[model samples]
Target: MPTEFQKRAGVFVGLVTCLLLPMWRSELYCYTVLCCFILGGTLEYWTAVYSRVSSLQDWAVYLILFMVWVLPTMAALHIYGGVIGHTRLVECLIIQLVVGDSAQLIVGRSIGRHHVCVKLSPKKTLEGYVGGFVLTFMYGALVHGWSPLNISVVYVFGCIGDLYFSGIKRRLGIKDYSRILSSHGGLLDRIDSFMFAANALVWKAFFFSPE
Candidate 1:
């Protein structure tokens, strides 16, 4: 029997392969992967919202919020990959987000003492936040020569993205979003930070020289 960590690692590798392989091989595959993620995330969002709310009036508000929040964030990937033809750029962003998130988890579990937000995300810690921030900033600088603002957008908004989903889960009284990804929960849970970082930084990349 595999332990929880093993299950998580397996799923993580598979997910990364699916995402990066498509980027290297074909644009169609990339879009296909994105569509799958958007559809899965949308369904999960709908499930959580629908289960909690009863009134159509309340549903209307959530529906609108969904359109506004989810679509634009996810579409940022398309802007980079499809519109900009910057697949490597997307790849770098994905790697940084993944590494930063992994750093947060590892450092948080090992030496984290002070909680960042006990109510929104009890497991998050200040030490973990700093660890992720410093490491991601350095890595981004070395790899992409990204500006401080760009690095901040990726790290800070990544944290915000995590907390955003966490707040939703707390409100809806559930965990993991869905059991689709074994120990890692749903696709949305895994890519929440990426979605937010891309959405926040993609436009900046368009307007200014990040290199």
Candidate 2:
């Protein structure tokens, strides 16, 4: 098994590659990358939740499919063309996932007595969530603008999304989604928050943006 530092370093490298793709490539390329992630995450989710063929149910499978695949794909498509466009949106998403999540982990470990959901993710805490939101809000405001509402909404949904997936993992009795990223777990674990936040942002952009 890789050490904690090695795991974090690997994740950092992956994040840097993801961030550079949009800046260096076209919107289509970014979209393609997003599609790949959505597909990969979907498979990982299915495997984690339904480890055996007999454990799968029709409704549950469909729901998982929609949530993990369809919704994120729609969000990715909209994000590719929304006012912010794919590049900028992806940049912000990466920042929220990387910086925001890092803050959550650090703060949670250092001074996190109140667990947000002890059963789902014991490492997560209310203090960590607050710290993450503060950092995320500051970063978003600095980069995008003083869009407090948008920042708050995205951060909230992101945390919820992370917890949602964590709950799934706990229920399924699995440690990580997969060992695809070595000690960092699967792609789904990394992008659970991103998928939810992207969907919310795309919805806001599409139906609520001012002309």
Candidate 3:
């Protein structure tokens, strides 16, 4: 197993490549990469739950398939259509996924005294959450000029989504979702927060757009 530093480095490198390559490439490339992520994440989630819950395996498979796969794909399609009229939406999403989550992990490990949810994720702390929000919001504001409301919405929902999946893993009694990403866990482990944040972004574009 890789050390904590090694794991963090691995995740950072992978996130940068996956996020920037498609963004700098083309819309079709972005769509293809997003689709692949959604599919892989769905499979990872399903696999994580399969052996743990024998009685609900069938239903869990379908539910994760929809939540992890279908929903994200739909949101990606909307984001791709220039819903926000800015290609920076993809960059913002990546910021939320990479910076926010990474900050939480690093800060939580360094000086995380107050546990946010000891049962679901023992290592999580209030300080870590705050650090993540600050870092994520600053980066988003600089890169995409995201409003306060946008930053708050995505941060809150992303944390919620991450905790929700953490609860699932706790229930299943698994350390990581899968070994697909080595020390980083599974694809779902990486993008679980993005799934929920993407949904919120889609809703914001549709129902709350000033245009």
Per-model TM values vs. the true structure: 0.85, 0.84, 0.84
List pairs with backbone clashes in candidate 2. none
Per residue, candidate 1 scores C-alpha lDDT tens digits across 132-156 of: 7888888777876767777887778
> How close to the true structure is residue 25 of candidate 3, measured as C-alpha lDDT?
61
Backbone collision tally, model 3:
0
After the best TM-score superposition of candidate 3, give how far the Cα of residue 42 lies from its true spot, in angstroms: 1.4
Clashing pairs in 3: none
Q: What are the lDDT figures for the candidates, one per model?
A: 0.73, 0.72, 0.73
TM-score of 1: 0.85
TM-score, predicted candidate 3 vs. hidden true structure: 0.84
Candidate 1 clashes between residue pairs 3 or more apart in a chain or in different chains: none
Measured on C-alpha atoms, candidate 3 has an lDDT of 0.73
* CA-only RMSD, every prediction: 2.5, 2.9, 3.0
Q: Candidate 3, after superposition: displacement of residue 165 in Å?
A: 0.9
Who is ahead in lDDT, 1 or 2? 1
Q: After superposition, how far is residue 32 of candidate 1 from its true place, in Å?
A: 1.9
Error of 3 at 74 (Å): 3.2
lDDT of 1 at 55: 88
